[model samples]
Every structure is written in C-alpha cells, then in structure tokens.
Target: MSGPVRSATTPSNPTDASDPPTSLNPILRGFNPDPTICVVLASGGTPTIFFLSTSTFEYFPGCAIYTSTDLLNRELIGHALKRRSQIELRTVKPGADSWASTLRYRPDEGRWYLANCLFQRYRPASDQRIFPRGFYVFTDNIWDDNAWSDPVYFGDPGFDQDLFWDDDGKVYLSTTTRLSDRAPDSTQKDLAIHISQMNICTGRTLTPPVVIRRSPHGIAEGSHIIGRNRIYHLFTAGGGTEAGHQGPDAPAMLLRRQTSFFQSLEVTMEFSTQQRGA
Candidate 1:
C-alpha cells in the first residue's frame, strides 16, 4: 500500500505534428501512500506549481507536502502538521495514528486546507469512543510550515474524509462511515459513504448526514467529489485495502450526479478494476 508517485506526460514542447508522448514514471519516490495532488495557479512571476500531500501515519510531522513546477522534479517542501501543539501522538497505536488526507487549494479564499483524521485511542474491547476524530488545518502560504493553523476538529464521521465546495457557496463533507459508529441495528458495512453540509471555517456540521453510496465489497474509502460541466463526479475506491486479498471484486467506481448531490443517482460505470492477474 506504499510506493512513489508516478507520472506520464508529453514533452513541454512538441517538436513534431505527429509524435508519441513521453513519460516520466516515478516522479516522486519514497513511501507516499494515499496521496492527494492539485494544481496551484501562478501568481505574479511565479510558475504554476503542482502540490502533493501524502498520509504520514505515526510520523512526527504528519502529512508530508511536496511541490513541483514541472511533473519531472519534486521537492519536499514541508508538512501540514509540524508543531506538537498541532497533533499529539503520545499513546497512539503504531501505524494507526493519522489516516488519509485531502489537500486542496482554494482560489477564492486564497488558502490551502488539509483535512485528515486521527485514529488515536481505539480500544474496541473496552468500547471506548475516543478515536477517529476528523479535523482540518489551513495555511495562507504553503511554503511556510509555521503558517498552518491549529486543527479545526469536526466531529468524527469516518476516515478518508473529503472536503468539497459546491456551486451555491456551500461546503460538503464526505467520508466512509465507521462500523463502530453505526447504530446497533444498522446494516451498513464498513463501506457506507455519507455526505453533509458543513461550515468549513468552523468545522461545524450544518446538516444531518445522508447515506450516499455503499460499495459492493466490505470496504469503501478514499472518495473524492469533483464538479465539472454542471455534473458532479464521484470517484470512490471500493474493495479491500490490502493487495493480496483484493481479488476481482476490487474496482474504482465513477458515479455521476447531474442535479443536486442530495438526489439519488444510479451507478454509471465500473470504470476501473484490479484483479489478481489483471
């Protein structure tokens, strides 16, 4: 589940009218899993930069950040969580501290937001509910590590949380529901995805959570919502987390919503699938 970031792109200047594209694979090396990348437009004389942030579980500076002007070369700029006051992991279980994160740059707000969850004190036998808290940290400047504000904690919905901005000036929070958080009689597996309107600045939920999609397998996480051409595209990872047991049931689904996101929409396609031999 851990590897480098690979990229395939054509040359900056195409020399011929008809030529095959070139590829630069493994652009960023090291164990960078559950990575989120975005393009930041250039301001003033600076070149447009591609920013990347990856999950750093149990690491001191959580959520390593990288930036690149071109797709070939990348630099480790800083981290989203740098200070001790930002995140505390004294007694957190190993390999279960910080989970997947969503990195975004808002042009209107002129800021960068990193949303993630902490799976700190999970004692299932004791039924203690003091783990899996979702929070976000913001920074006006991505280059400055100290500029990231303290985490604004939103109530724990689940892991692999996503922050999405709608056209009507509303921010929506999407996440996979944890099995422990469900009701006693609830039939939801570890695959349910929920959406809710939220106050992004204050980390406050403005509406009740709605069940959107449940994966066919028992696990569904890493869901992202993007809007284009008046249609909202939901890209979600469905199946097991590990590699050996993924089998033929593991597929990445693409669901589309033409109207409001709250409306019911059918699954449009099973866009990508990973099997044992495929």
Candidate 2:
C-alpha cells in the first residue's frame, strides 16, 4: 500500500528554532522499493518527472506511478497495469511477484516503457525455484492505467532488468547474469552484468548478450542505464544489501562508455560506503 504524499525538499537551517519547517521528506513510503524515475521537459520547459516502483507480490493494480513538476511534491498519478491479463499473482509466492523495475520514455516512439523481472514460487516437487522472466510493456499515455499494453515476455536475462534508448534510435536492455564461459572473462564464474540490443516493439534481443562488467565482491545486480552528453553510464549495486556484512566492497558502482553506446564499458567510479537498495 502507498503512504501519504510528502515533500522532498528540506530547509537549510535546522538550528534556527524560528525557522519554519520546510522539509517534508520521502515522496513515497510504506512497502515501496526499487524506484526508477524518468524526467521529461514540457513544451514550456517545465520539468515533469514520472516514477515507478516495485510492488513485489502485492495484490492487483501492481506498480504504482507518481508524478511531480518541481521534484519536491509528488502526486499518485495511477498504475501501469490494472487487469489480470497484465499481471497474474495467483501462483507467485509472497514477495516474489515483481522485482526491481525501470521506467523509460522513448521520444522516438512517443511512448513510455517499463521493464521488470517476474519471480515465481519454488516447486517443492522439483526442488527448484523457477528462473525469473523479464518482460516489458509500453503505453502512449502514462497517466492512464488502461493504456498499458499486455506484457511481452523476453528471455530470462537476469534480475532487475533495465531498458536504455540511445540517441541513435537503438534500444538496449541491461540485466544481471552469470559470467560468460567464453574467453576474456572474470575469475568470478558466478555473476556479471549483460547488455544486448532489444526490439522495443516485440521485446526480442537482436544481438548476443555481452558481459559488460563482472562483480568483484561476490555479487552484483540492479542495473540502470542513462546517456548524457554522448556518454553512456551504467549504475549497479553489489556486495549485497546488508550494511555490516558487505565488508570492504561498495554498495554502488558506476561504469561508463564514451566511444559508443554498446561498446566495452569500464568501471570508472564506485561508492564504497553508499547503501544502495534495489
């Protein structure tokens, strides 16, 4: 369930008792996690931000959306999927219906896109948990709940999938996967991040998935991609989510590709102490 809307801005002077309380904090509360935001500037140059968060086994009306004009105050716009055809949770276990998701606006297509991994319950008979499947849906109108298209399932790339639409009109999908068995790979054989060219209309990959980054600290997930000033940046979280147990490895890591959108990416920076959540 969602919480009351609150302001994100805070006052500069907290010591002054006479100063009015200007900060409300937390634009969203309650079980809301793994938020992805997309910003668009209107014709008048006013900034409009759209936010989507994981619902994770919650009942129908999954993945709520919030919008804000100034980034301080956010209003509950609506949900992207509202029908049983869009999302079915009858067979999913608690807290496994949906994982980390991303919201992206494609200017070329004039539509908004949302990509996420759907988790299924473990089968006791087979003693195995079903691999999470990644899917995406788009809507011409982001403000309407009924505008979202049916889920178009893609290959099970990994958890926390994200979509990156580059200026060259090519689309890419990034997700966590196991280290490739091919040559020139990481010593850590278990986990890595992968990216591939994706067809926005059919949710199909056109190229073989390439390993962009390998986890140095035993684990890595939660991939997000953005392009700015001819540079593409990828943000990911590793070393687990817990605080003290993470040891020396950072919670968040950054990788960059300046030459092209889908070329080799090198880790440029890392936040050792930052507590990044999926």
Model 1 lowest lDDT segment of ten = 244-253
lDDT per residue (tens digit) for residues 52-142 in model 1: 9999888878899988777666778888898877888887887678888999889998999999988876445544345466899999999
lDDT of 2 by residue, 1-278 (tens): 33346565555686776775565535565556778888775756645565555554555677878776666666777777778787787787766777778888766667888887667763345433355668888898987788999998776467778888777778888887666563454344355678888887787888888877666675567788778666777787776545622554444456565756556777677665444331
Worst 10 residues of 2 by lDDT: 122-131
TM-score of every prediction relative to native: 0.83, 0.81
Cα lDDT of all candidates, in order?
0.76, 0.70
Itemize residue pairs with steric clashes in candidate 1. Answer: none
Backbone clashes in candidate 2 total 0
RMSD of 2: 4.2
- List the candidate 2 regions with Cα displacement exceeding 4 Å: 1-4, 15-27, 44-47, 122-129, 180-189, 242-250, 258-263, 274-278
